[model samples]
Target: MTPYLNLVGRDGIVVLIGAIDMVPRFHSGNLLMRRRSLSASMIGGIVETQELLDFCAHHGILPECELIAMADINEGFGRMERNDAKYRFVIDMATLERK
Candidate 1:
């Protein structure tokens, strides 16, 4: 985040990940006061979730991802272990073969 701070200009938006519960302290006391704000939010409950998905579908929005075969699971894991950003890696388990 230090690199990001250096690049942030006036009124830049900084979004944090939901699982990152702790706040990062900046060495400069006025950093937070420099017209910048941070946001991290948890997903809403079932109805809101359904609504969000519905909205996305209505707008033809979908996640950018690459599908890998179940047989290549180990290869995928190996790539992830190497910090490859080639895939989003999320999958729909319902669509998987039992084998």
Candidate 2:
């Protein structure tokens, strides 16, 4: 998670949600994969979708270029809802480039 946060803070690397599973079921013979969770939160503000889009554009980053990966869970559902509803602040790393 620290690595992900640091990467997001960097100048070139871009991070975005790629995939999501609403209901995941493993087969009897399937093996469970290990994963780590990394998420950040903001306290206030009604972040608009257009503001996020414009921010990404100003930073030379495309939201479509990034990918988010998630599994089937309540947290995942919440994230999907937040993203689809465009309720969080988005930071574009591409804007940190040298002028």
Candidate 3:
């Protein structure tokens, strides 16, 4: 199996797979950038922002932002690896944000 890495941004931690290409989009007069091209293994389980941050810090991976967004097109269906319970949660980065 290929090792997975977390995508970190100013908005938050992005739980996705593959190379993430961030693009600026205009939505209803609001300018926003969405992280795209995320695969299943990239975020097949629950992830905490602190865990991601600590991982990055230990690995020397610098984050460009503090905002995070998760994209699971399958809603986490059929993405289990050997029926592991670790893949049954939706991690919300907002909860881990520093006030």
lDDT (C-alpha, whole model) for all candidates: 0.69, 0.40, 0.40
Candidate 2 is scored at a TM of: 0.23
Q: Model 1: per-residue lDDT, tens digit, 4-76? A: 6655555656677566667777655335656765676776889999999999999999988867766677787
| lDDT tens digits by residue: candidate 2, 27-99 | 3222212232232334234466677767888999854333323233345456655554233334344444465
Residue pairs in collision within model 1: none
- Per-residue lDDT tens digits of candidate 3, residues 1-99? 112212322233324454456523323212124332322343423456678877999999974432223444244444443333343355455555465
Which regions in candidate 1 have their CA more than 4 angstroms from the true location?
1-39, 91-99
Q: C-alpha displacement of 56 in model 2, angstroms?
A: 0.9
| Candidate achieving higher TM-score, 1 or 3 | 1
* Model 2 regions lying over 4 Å from their true place: 1-33, 38-47, 64-99
Q: Rank the candidates by TM-score, best first.
A: 1, 2, 3
Per-residue lDDT of 55 in model 1: 100
- Please tell me which model should have the higher TM-score, number 1 or number 2: 1
TM-score of each: 0.52, 0.23, 0.20
Top-scoring candidate (TM-score): 1
For candidate 3, the lDDT comes to: 0.40
